[model samples]
Target chain A: MFPVFEIFGKQIGVYGIMAAVGFVACFLVGRLLIRRYDIDIYDFALTMIAAGIGMAIGASLLYAATNYRYLFYGFSHFYEIGWSGLWMCVKTALDGFVFYGGFIGAAIGILIYTKCAKDVKAHRDHLLDIYAVLVPLFHGFGRVGCFFGGCCYGIESPFGFTVHNNHLNPAINDVNRFPVQLLESGCNLLIFLLLLVLFKKHIMEKRLIYLYLLIYPIVRFSDEFLRGDGIRGSLFGLSTSQWVSIILFIFALVMLPIKTKKLKAQSAQAAESDAD
Target chain B: MEQQQGKKGFAIASLVLGIVACVISWWGLVLGIIGIICAVIGLILAIQAQKSYKAIGQKNGVATAGLVLSIIGLILSIIGTIACGIVCAAGTAIANDSRIANQLLDQISSSVN
Candidate 1:
């Protein structure tokens, strides 16, 4: 798969280009979607910046966790390993990222933003509603980036892409891979369309995030089976992402009912007080 | 409103920083990183300026331009960083793996023949 292109005498990553494209698309769509809400556009933009920073930190930390042995060895033998060797260990430990880590980090980032920016917090439900709509749309483009970048590849199969010249992940080279990235991208786009329809019709109101959490995890859980990248550690015979998906699915299932119950209790309390 | 007018200095600073970032991003890795930092600051300033206008239900042309330019600078700086990092990492991998070097060389020689 082609990952890089020559631009202005520099080798620009296709992944970055796709990311930029995704952000622009999200910004335009989000602008339209938020018109119904009282939230400011800059507040939304600032929240996204927080999410981006959080994603970077979380992904790096998870990657380091995956290579803990290397990090330990690097630190323990600091004298013998020398500066270059230590740097090598550190670099190898932190070079890659886990998508699940980034996803969780982004959730925390948004939560933190709402807490700090009280004005934005007042419109929390509306903010989350728009976020739920935009996540899948942006994710679809990211998967496309993964497809071209030859990362997160599908399992080996006869009737699929025979990727070569992928120097970064040489495991992908000269293999007929199943193109799971593109498949997931397509699935994400379909989910995005469904969410968009729901948003446009104002069908789910503030519950769109729950709907997304329910649907996307099922999709992710099933798709994890098709992914060939085995670097992501598994626990209890299930890949990390699959386990995360299951946990998220169950979390949503549990939280939705509790959230509904709380809202109902609050409204009932307000009614009783008003009557007095 | 007064609040919107009060943010004019921020909009101007954002525009200036964004312009500087865009110019320096093309140079190399270190400059690219610095450019990205500048772009980020510019973006924040622009957002603050725009938020003031938006709060009062007004639009500011300068804030819009700053936002647009800062985004462009960020993208450019990111591209430069990606390109440099890729070249470095791939180069190191190639140096260590003889099979990869052989494969690449074979391809080149085959094409030449």
Candidate 2:
């Protein structure tokens, strides 16, 4: 796991670089999809940027929130600690980020974008379907980055591989662990492909986002069990992400019915008006 | 037209706050904190303006700019705050450590004499 390496005598994180790559890839693919749908490319770009900003804030805030006890302890012991200690505290607080937080943040960003961008506002549902496709596509790359960064690692297994001299998490060093990151990455890629196929076939239409919501939460909940990292925080023997997954899954289930009912009502009303 | 003006006002306010936040972000810790607060408020106002524009079937360029700028300013302010905190903490630690070391040397020398 090569977390950091030098490029032209400058240190760069593999995770950050991969995430950036994923962002660019998402934007490029999004542009293509938007063009195909006859949506304004510029507006798509702006919305994508907004989603990126939201993702950054949401991810960091969730990271900090999950480690709230540590942050509070740091603040409480602020007067007693040296500069190094303070640096460590702040660094830790800023380092780890949760993906669910980013997803929620991006959703908010899209909402804001829909308001701000005229064309996007007019075609919000279509754009959101595209956005749903992009999520797993981007996340797939991010999980690969996590693999390279040696974070979000899996539990020990005889069939797994060992990571040696891992500076990021020394606890996992020399320990044979399940390759959970790779597994998640593979799963995400499959999901991305499945969504793309659904999109192409026009099967779900505006309900694509709901499909993602229904699918991803189950995968995340199951994958959480294989995750070895404790920094994600846990409550009642379930990790934070697991709890979020449960909520998202149930929310999706409830929303699916309501959305179908509303769509039906709208179509019925349109039909009645046409008959008149 | 009146609602449009209201939306414009919020957009302008958001843009101004966003600019101020970015400008003062790197000044100091307190200023960075202020910048962050301003950015957050600007973001909220920008969202409100965007919502208003959507309801009225219009798009406000200024509001979009405000939202984007506010996000930038907020991120910069947060980074600035962390950087400032780290530098000050490191300086204090180095100074305190050196001072303690000096005092210990003086005590040892005086006791020997």
Candidate 3:
């Protein structure tokens, strides 16, 4: 529950610290991989920057969408509250963001980066394979941050530790709750390791990204059930993330075969050309 | 070859900036903010370095390390800023509430006396 800590009279957020650590770890690991694969570092840096921007935008937009009441209230009372209030409302809206939105945004960013960068476009499959592993590695750190920040808490459960004075969510306070954040973080780490091993072994080839898409959605779909927070909107009796997971899972399922077939065809053509 | 030499200079500069950013990030919010700015510039330099390296068919590990460190510094600084904001807001709210409570108590005592 230690969201903020002071050092040398300056407050530091644990979540931010963890995220920073994650980003560094991801970058270092990915750099090693880029070297191994002989990928273009400049293109990698550009793609990362694009993805970071996209994630920031997507996360904030989705947060605002899910918490529409805040916007409605702010708009309705805009005249009465004036500029300072409106500014505060905007600040508040930007503070909390959904991870799924960031994920989707990053994917879109990578796609756009690939389209624009000719060198990266040529090595899209390999880059995507690296990205697939990076996502989970970064996300795992984020989950740890969530746990310390006392956000995205799980339902009351006698099996887990009780939280006290949880500043982020009072509902989670004074009750034993499942450590869903830690569980998810652990799961993500496992997935990262698995993907890394598969990648090193050259097991899945170009289908690695699809494998991640297929696997993570299922984990997320089930994990949503354990999640206690309702800040992330719901539709048709399922949370926004759950719905997104289902959609993504289906998309991955459909795209897997198509992409595999396309790759096989391309390879066959290359082989024939080489033979000639 | 000249441009390649210039790129190497950028890579070294980026690496130095990245290290400075990461170190200064822990000092204070103001320093952290400066670190973030430095990190952004460092990242740009690292990218340039990488592009140059690619042109020369060489791998620039220093540029990669610089890019990684810079990103980490930026994230830390941003988090430090948010933490400061939250703490400040909470402090202000508490002070206001205490002031109102003290004023009410003083008024009650004066009236009773």
Candidate 4:
């Protein structure tokens, strides 16, 4: 119901506000981390700009590509088309932003920016750690937006959520639907908090960022099952994302032991050399 | 030697992004090539950056791993590309056949009328 909040003449969706909130939260976290580790602010600013723009463009493009039907379909009836015209296409393109797409896009933007940046402080691990934490936190807000907009609705359940009646969204049928969007947001928040704790304990290194990869896909892959939207697809008896998750999880597990062993060996060598 | 945190951050970001790219575009041939290129290029740059940092007396192996991850991403991207192509072609074929069936239905209805 509150998906499209009218502010002045413009309509701002909850998703957009959530995105802004995520950005602010990320900036604050980044600033705090940079200050703690004596990282340069300019570098943070540069990377944020690159990543933010990348996420936006990437999410939008992916949404348009994946949901091409709804976006491309003129309308089942002439009366519907008469009201919107091609403007609906443009609107749908903008509105169908996907989270995974944005994540990849932002990462690419940061990578490219890092490659080109000339500043001395641009390549700091502390900055990376801050980003690592921020990505999940901000993405959490985006999921909340999804919930508010009723875009990523859940399946039927006995005691489930109902979309309030409003101009922007009708009361969604099926009361048995699980609040999957909220569940996702909750998971993301938990991850963010966990990351914060690790950072506070000074246990985080650049390697910790890779843990995000291992964790997020697992959460998303599981959540795919509860999603009521037509987005879920099973490939060879496993959900597409779940299949990807299995591979990524296996890869992470394989790498973890080796990485730990390598670090132990390196530290041991250092200790021996230092003693000599 | 203590590695500066900044260089490590850059490397990690590059590696994560590279892996993500490989996974996302894994459904398309062009995207797979691009993902591999990104991963490779990212890995090389990250490695160079890590080396430069180490040369200045900062020991940051984490950054080095980021470079290595990018290479892994490149391999995964290639695999993803082949998978994506097969799926896409199959999907396109199915959609085309469906469209033809729909057209035939319309034609049959008109003839009967």
Q: What's the CA RMSD for each of the models? A: 6.1, 9.5, 7.3, 13.9
Off by over 4 Å in 3: B1-38, B53-72, B81-113
Shift in Å, residue A119, candidate 2? 3.1
| Candidate rank order under lDDT | 1, 3, 2, 4
Residue A16 of model 4, lDDT score: 53
Docking class of 3: incorrect
lDDT of 2 at A60: 75
Pick the TM-score winner. 1
Q: Can you tell me which runs of candidate 4 are displaced by over 4 Å?
A: A68-94, A120-124, A164-176, A232-234, A237-240, A254-276, B1-113
lDDT (tens digit, per residue) of candidate 4 on B1-113: 32543466577677676666656544544566577567756665565567667557676666666766775675555334321111111121122354743453344334433
The deviation in Å at residue A59 for candidate 2 is 1.0
Specify the poorest-scoring 10-residue window by lDDT in model 3 chain B: B84-93
Q: Residue A171: error of model 3 in Å?
A: 2.7
Best by lDDT: 1
**lDDT for each residue of candidate 1 in A24-44, tens digit (9 for 90 to 100):** 898899888878885677888
Please report, as a residue range, the 10-residue window in candidate 4 chain A with the lowest summed lDDT: A166-175
lDDT of 4 by residue, A1-276 (tens): 356555444344566556656676887877887777665554565577678768767876765565344344434422444444444434433444567677778877777777777663446445556777888899788788777766666777765676555333332443456888889999999999988888878773555566777898889888888876544234576654576577767776787667667768878999999999
The per-candidate TM-score of the B chain, in the order shown, comes to: 0.71, 0.70, 0.69, 0.52
- How well does candidate 4 reproduce the true complex, by DockQ? 0.03
- How displaced is residue A152 in candidate 4, in Å? 0.9
| TM-score for the B chain of model 1 | 0.71
